[model samples]
Target chain A: MTADVRDVWTYLADTPLLGLTATLIAWDAASWIWRRARMTPLLNPVLLAIVMIVIFLSATGIDYRRYFAGAQFIHFLLGPATVALAIPLYRQIHALRRSALAVTIALAFGSVTAAASAVGIAWALGASRSTILSLAPKSATTPIAMGIAKEIGGLPSLTAVLVLLTGIVGATMGPWLLAKLKVADPRAQGLALGVASHGIGTARALQSGEVAGAFSGLAMGLNGLATAILVPLLVRWLLN
Target chain B: MLSYITVLLGCQLAGETIVRLLGIPIPGPVVGMVVLFLLLAIRGGVPEGLDKVGRALLLNLSLLFVPAGVGVMVYLQRIAKEWLPISAALVIGTLITIAVTGLAMSALVKGRRQ
Candidate 1:
């Protein structure tokens, strides 16, 4: 019986199924808890899932690389899902056009502020140069942020983690902060979330309403562009 | 659903090709989003099947980040070394960015209306 159980473990480890199953199970369990907890932002499903998976991997003596070998299947879908952002964006095309100028101004400021503030605070707090660079693009989506971090002399992997943390922070605290500030407009609120948090914030915005979701999507995309352009320039001026 | 997936992946492929060719700084998927948006605009309507697929994908969007988020464990040592600065910057910077952007956008929109 012991030999058979070890054999089964070895077989599962050799394939992607274990990693895939773990990811799904962790997310489902996290989501269930989130829902049961009254959907509080404090209990963010993604954050919960990550914590659970990390604990699981650590306990099992499994490394992230092995887990990612299976999780990559889900990760690859991020690309197509990003492309699908067009659907909600298209649904709100008219509204987008109507607020083009407002979006442009808001995005310009938000993008610059997002990168600058993160970098500034980190620098003042005595983080290293590469760390500062990685944190600079935290507001952009993961792929774009990772790319920018590489271009600007930072660890891409570290940047990816910072971007994730930024998203969680933004998604969890952003709506409440906005409400406190009396930024009651859905478009504005969504745009802020996207600019500050990227896709995760956009996910939170989607729960608010379609209008907020659409604008959040728009803000996320534009913030990527603006941050990509601005961060390099800011790096040159601030770092060099 | 398959066709919708095809269109999305195709656009992303084209976008990746374009970015590589032009050395564009933006990610390919974002450009693919633009291409998809344009295509939908030209068609003047979203097909029901495509809409369903898109919604399903977006609905589960947060789940997609799970893999990457879990990968944070790999950087545990680096993060632990800079935990204070990192945490402060993430929390404070994000809140300030949200406030600045939200306030600016709302004010601008209201000004435009006036």
Candidate 2:
């Protein structure tokens, strides 16, 4: 029985469908549970999904790289999904125009602060150079953040992980922080979420409404651009 | 859906070319996003097809990060050693950013009115 079970496991692992199926199932289960929990920030679906999948892979003795081969289909969608950000951003044009100057200035300021603070605090706390570099680009979406991390002498994989963690944590904690700060405007809250957390945060922002979603989308793009341009130079200057 | 996907891919392809030729540090899709944004601004409205696809993608955005997020396991050792700094930076850093950006946006926009 044990021998047969091992053989079956090996056979399943060799196929390409496991990663895709596992990801979908994990996300579904996570989402269902999170919703059942009343969408509590503590059990964010993304975070829950990640934890579930991580354990499944370890228990199954499946290599992550192998899992990625099947899962890359979902990952491939990130490209088009990223391009899609412009839609909501464009939807908010009128709102954007009213506070364009404020938004732009705040984008620059927040982008700088996001990167600088992550790097500064980590480094001061005794993280290695590579670790500091990885932390620097945590606010942007994974692809852009990973690109910036690679350009700035960081571990791109590490940056990818940090970016997700940042997004999950930001999305989870952001609303509470905003409420505490008396940020009454949904649009402003969305901007804060996007500038600070990227896609996952934007996902959370969208739950509030279109205006919030739009601002979050706009903030995501502008923050990505600002970090892409500024972090390389900033990392170079700071590390040297 | 196919045609709309093409528009996005076309922009991304063009953006990739520009980035390669110009040595720009930003990601190609982002530059493509800017191009798409400018084009939409000129058009004065989003095409229904693209909007449909894009919104669908946005609605399920977090679903796509699962694969990459799992890669965290690969660094278990490093993360374990540096857990303190990593956790502190991510948690504290994110809270600070949220507050600063939110307050700044609210104050600046309101200040403009007064």
Candidate 3:
């Protein structure tokens, strides 16, 4: 039985189907659990699915590169999805116009604060420079964060993982924390979540309402742009 | 759907070109997004087909990250070695970021109200 199962696994793994199928299955299973949990923020479907897939791959001894070959299909959606953010932003033109200046200010302040504090904390904790650089872009969306990390001497792969963790944490705890802070405005809530967490937090913000989702998308994009420009200059000035 | 996608990819390509030409460090897609947003604002509305396609993409946005997130497996050794600082920075930094951005924006937004 063991030998037969091993043969079956090898056949599947040899094709491009394994990673693609595993990702869908893992997310489907995660969504099931998330639904079972009544969509609790703590069981964020992305985080749950990542944990599930990581464990399966580790247990099966499938190389991460091999799995990524198939999984990259879904990954292609990020570009289009990011571009798609324009739709929601377009939809919220009236409200966005009202809060435009405020959003800009918040994004600038928030972006600098998040990156500086993370780099500062990591530096104080004795993390290596590479690790600190990797941590600096954690609040931006994954691609931008990875790109900035590479430009700044950080390992892109390490930054990728840190970015995911940052997003997951932001999505999970943001709303609860905001409520505690008496932050009642959706624009502020969504903008904060986006600046701090990027796409994953924007996903969570979408669940709140169109207004929040729109602003979150705005913040996510603006923060990505800001972080790209700001982190390097800040690092040069402050760290050097 | 296809034309709408083309427009998006086209903008992304333009963004990449602009970034490379100008030596800007931001990701291509983000500039792609800004370009698309500006075009739509000038047009005064999202086209129905593009709106539908874009909405579908955003609705399922989280799925796109799973592949990258799986790369965590490759860093198990590093994570194991530095879990303390890594975890501390993530949790503490995230909370502070959320608090600062939210409060600062709220304060500014409220200032606008008064």
Candidate 4:
């Protein structure tokens, strides 16, 4: 019995498929929980999935590098997936065109406010400079947040965690926050969710309606651009 | 399908190139997204294969984060040690971001209406 168990462990460790299997299981478990809970944001699929994978790997004494080695195919697809966001944005081009000025201004103000308040509050609360940097771009999508973190001397790994947490929080509390403020328009809800939360919020917005999804998509794209330009420039200005 | 793969690869390459040349602090995919946006804006539509590839990619987006999520293992100690500070920052920062951005966007839209 012990020999069989050891063999199984060795097989899992040797093949990348074990990591992929873990990924699928975690995602499915998260989806099941979300469905049972009526799509509560706190039961966010990504957060739940990550928790599941972490617990599994830690328990089995498997290292992350081995898991990632088998899972690089999935990671490689993120590039295309991000680029695909433009298609939805393209479909909503007319609406985006009409709201060009509004989107631009909202993005500018929102991006600055998002980055500044995070760094300021973190610093005020006595976080290290690296922690402040990690938190600065938490509102943006994962990739951009990671880049900003690296540029400003934060730990990329920490920023990734912060990014995931930001998404989960935004997805979970976003609707409630909007409702409390009496912001009922789907477009407004979607845009707010996307700008503040990024892809995860947009996923939640998709459940509302196509219009909401469209606006959310627009917000996501514009926020990415706004933060991309403004975060580094602002950091440079502030630090210098 | 092949065409979609080509365009996807092409755009990704172009995006990486632009980022390196411009010294943009953003990721390559983000820059590719911007480039794709421009191309669509100029051409007035996404090429056919591009749409299919994009849809496929988006549907499976969650899976892509698996590797990164696993990387969390590397920071277990940091997270354990700094749980309070990290959680505080995330919770507080998210609330502020939601409140300020939500209000600011609502006001901006309302101002436009007025």
**Candidate 1's residue-wise lDDT over A1-240, tens digit each?**
999999998788767898999999999999999999977666878789989999999997888898899999998888888788778767765667978889999999899889989999999999888889889999998767876787778877677768878888898889999989999999999999999999889889999998899899889877876787789889989987
Using DockQ as the measure, name the better of candidate 1 and candidate 2: 2
Q: Which ten residues in a row have the lowest lDDT in candidate 1 chain A?
A: A86-95
Better of 2 and 4 by lDDT: 2
Ranking by DockQ: 2, 3, 1, 4
How high is the CA lDDT of each candidate model?
0.86, 0.85, 0.85, 0.77
Candidate 3 regions with alpha-carbon error over 4 angstroms:
A1-8, A171-186, A199-214, A236-240
Going through the candidates in order, state the TM-score of chain A alone for each one. Answer: 0.84, 0.86, 0.83, 0.87
Query: What lDDT tens digits, residue by residue, belong to model 3 across residues A1-240?
Result: 999998997899877799999999999999999899987667777778989999998888889899999998998877767777767766765557877888888888899888988988888888877788889989988877876887788877688778878988898889999999999999899998999999779889999998788888889877887898898888778667
List, residue by residue over A1-240, the lDDT tens digit for candidate 2. Answer: 999999988888978799999999999999999889977666777778888998999998899999998999998887777777777767766567877898887777789889988998999999988889889999987777876777777887688778878887898889998999899888689899999999778878989888788889889877887888888888878878
The candidate with the higher TM-score, 1 or 2, is: 2
What TM-score do all the candidates reach, one by one? 0.89, 0.90, 0.88, 0.90
Per DockQ, the best of the predicted structures is: 2
DockQ of 3: 0.65
lDDT value, candidate 1, whole model: 0.86
lDDT of 4 by residue, B13-86 (tens): 89889889997777787788878888888898777777877888887776676667667778788777767667
lDDT of 4 by residue, A8-35 (tens): 9898787999887888888888889988
